[model samples]
Target: MPDSQIKFLVVDDIRENMVALEALLRRDGLQIDFAGSAAEALELMLVNDYALAFLDVQMPETDGYELAELMRGAERTRNIPIIFVTAADRDERRHFRGYEAGAVDYIFKPLDPVVLRSKAAVFFRIGQQARELECQRDEMRVLAHHRDIAISRLKAHADNSPLALIECDRNLTLRSWSKGAERMFGRSAEAMLGQRIAQSGWLDAEAAGILQTWVDGGTSAQRHSAEIDARRADGQTISCEVFGSTLCDLNDGNLSLSLQLLDVTERRRAEEVRSLLIGELNHRIKNTLANVQAIARQTLRQADSLAGFEQGFVGRLQALARTHSILSDMTWSSASLDQLIDEQIRAGTLDAARLLRKGPTVQLTPENALRLALSLHELGTNAAKYGALSVPGGEIRLTWTYNDELLVLRWEERGGPEVHPPARTGFGTTLIRASAGCEDDGVSVDWSASGVIWTITLSVGVAQPNQPDQERLIEPAKIESGRPELDGSRVLVIEDEPLVALDIRYELTAAGAGKVDIARSIGQALEAIRAAEIDVALLDGNLSGERVDEVANALRGRKIPFCFVSGYGRQHLPQGFQDAPIIEKPFRADALLPVIHELIRR
Candidate 1:
């Protein structure tokens, strides 16, 4: 309303006088209202606010004098300034009457335009000043209201934030302690405010010194953050992360800081545990890899031929893998004895139907379980080849008994070919004996007339031997009744992994093969075949991830008698090599001997 037009009222019985006065007063931001009689002027005054009123002294019926009296009587219209419009020939009594009737001044009938404007401009200026003052008052009221709301919102944030919010001067005198801060230190705001920061006793002497130094450094927000062990009101020590910043209030000449702290005790503990687990994992991995490498070397040294070496070496690796799988399932703590026996027998491809096992539920530590698995696999394979399991009617009874101090496992055979002691100890015999790790009473094999009887005795809950000594790696007497026909046969081995290729070379050379050649990729294999005459070749089913059919075709064209060696079993054989004799990885020398002999005959 103050910003709208400034209006003024003019009351006159004659239209000419009113029109002339209205024109003089009318300008930008000013509105003039005209009325012919006292009744009309009173009505105009009641509905609108006017800056100035000019009334005629002489009028019909209800005159200007009566209107002035009426306006003065009413509360809404009393404050408006009124000037009388009169004739130039007015008597003194008429002038007195106008003055006494509440008219501030009089104007003549023959008006002076410049004089009229000057007088009316005074009242208009006063009205404008009053409106401006009122507007300024309203603006100040709004600004005060906003300031109160802002303070309330800031207080709410300080009370409800998850982090402890503390405000202090650079000298470390506390200024504000939020509800969050109170909860963290177990102290109330009233008790904390105005006190020195360390007075709350939340930190130890050393921790307090560190925090004081940091505050003195005048670091910006989040520029200085640290983890410190702090004490709570209950005297419990906890890890806390402190973050702070210097406030931008340099004009006050006193520096301040806003500090926030969060509890990180659980997170620190978790990190410590994770680091220990990583170290343990790394140590276990390195040890396991070394053990496997040694097994491969020992198996190769005693193998009589490539075929035998593949069989023995692969079987040992499989046994170790299966044992590790069970140990992993048990978190490497212990393993079930029944599970170890079942896995080793199945992996050796032995006839479980002809065997019976009777034992109470038994659990062995990880180390003992590994050794026992290797021994069981060897015994199973020997029975299938030459002892009880060779005949369908033969049966092997395995039984075990364990107590607090000792564990005894027995293997008995019946209804098979007559048994007799071998001429020399084989690798399997040495392995099972070493696994026993006993001098007086360990492992024994009785070549009884009915079948072979094997028994292993071990100390329960005692440390077994970690690994067999390399000096104990015996070169066994040949298993073949007659010397292998491959005596001096030149052989080519195609395998991708370097260690596996070297193992194959060792076995073939030991088996009386002459000048064994090795190739990794298909191109290298084909080139080797062209450079020399190869009597027989062992083809890897897969080179990297691809089928090695192209290299097989080259061998076929050369009329070389070769067999497929695949670790993935028959399902993964090279497409065109289906007609070739195939042997899976990890075969015993006996299994490979027949494959090589068959190829030689072909």
Candidate 2:
């Protein structure tokens, strides 16, 4: 007899009959689960995979007919075959009714154990065949997709007419050369086809030696690059950057090499002009920095005494430091508009109390965050010194909106002593606008007697979806002793943080884990999985700097179920890793218990 791995669900109101059927099926190497009612059976089906279900036709609430109908309604359990175990007489009406209720076959009591085993074997074989065919279809689909992408890339390269395309065999025999190659080297494919490239007239003595060394290796698998001057067919020398690398067959066993030759003379000449301009720009920046530093020193030195210097020089330096801090927060790039305003306004100060900030979340890339932060600093400083924030009962409102993909941020102030425009342009205005200049997008400001208003519109990248919170389900009014059965299975805990690892270990043990093993690293986790059978695992996304996906794959390879517990958002989770239960960081113990039991039963 062949060993069978098919699982069967045994549903019956009578516990004795269920046990008898289980005993009979055990001889055939079938794993079985016994359910007292159809509702219990359906709940089992939701989380477990069984080749067939032996459902009793008549039972308490939700008999086999109602149970089968519900199963058919659910996408996850619709495919499981149902075999009716009933005492219904052999009437055509009852037979038709059973078929309508999604039963594959109906059996009468007193049951024949031998006949029941034979019928189940047939459906089990069918399920295995269906699974195998699906796997094959998926493999073919992946192969076809890769082939299409390769063909598309090849067409793009061919149509663009790159500087030169060279194709050679294992022995350095020229097989194909493109038109661009002919124009660059003054040699046609018709003249070079089927000829040894070493015998070609292009290479000089030193180049020939290098080419021969590469050819002696059958084919140079790694890229070989060199800049060399070679005489064309007309005896005029041209400088080219030649690169060669091997290509392997996508399907069958075959190998070849392709070389590309690029003409870089024009680009090299342009680099010289760019270098001169860059040097002049650098010198101008240095000169400007020196002048600004001298002016700052002069302003402080001309003050009456130490107290004046502290009041003048120290304030400006602190403002500069605040701008620098905001820039650093953005990694020296753009900062979010709201974050800029919040950071520049001291919490206990009038600027903070009078400020009103409202906007959707927006992120500035490094350069923009810094510029926006500096501009925001100037606004906050001016308000503190003279505008709304400087007076009692003053107010400021900052609002932003996204209209048709444009990010518009507004800074409006009011409720201060009647405002007035500055008598003359000052360094504050220069620095504020200069910071905005870092962005290609234009920035505009309006200074009014009532208040100062500034608005800037810039492009912002779209945001990805946030991780979904746990689903809410209605629990049974009162759980009977047999209410929802928690799985009594082994669990593995893989977390590098010792505190987190111990917490998971304690919870699993309290949750009735028969055996719980803790692994702090990827290597240990794999070893634990291999040495002991695991029913479920709770893994951290970063275990010894390795992704939890690696642990997931190992569990999948063994047909074990596992869930991830990560501080990182679901977006950071590896692909194909989400469907399995994920408990986000700071999850409660109660939430994890249900998922563990669900996956375990699966």
Error of 2 at 594 (Å): 97
Q: Model 2, residue 477: displacement in angstroms?
A: 99
- For residues 1-602, could you state the per-residue lDDT of candidate 1 as single tens digits? 34467888989889998888888888888888889888988899899988889998778898788888899999999888889988764788877877776777788868888888888888889878777777788898898899889989988987888788888887778898889877877878897788876776766777667667766776444466778887777788878898877765758666777788887888898888889878988987787778778777877888889878877777877787778777877778888777787776555444566767776666788778888888888887888888888887997788877656577889898888999899888778877886666555688778889888888887864332333212111122222344365778888999998887887787677777877899889889999988888888988888887778788889988899888877654556656566787665655555566577668767
Best by TM-score: 1
TM-score of 2: 0.30
| Candidate 1, position 586, lDDT | 52
Worst 10 residues of 1 by lDDT: 469-478
Best by lDDT: 1
- Candidate 1 TM-score, true structure as reference: 0.58
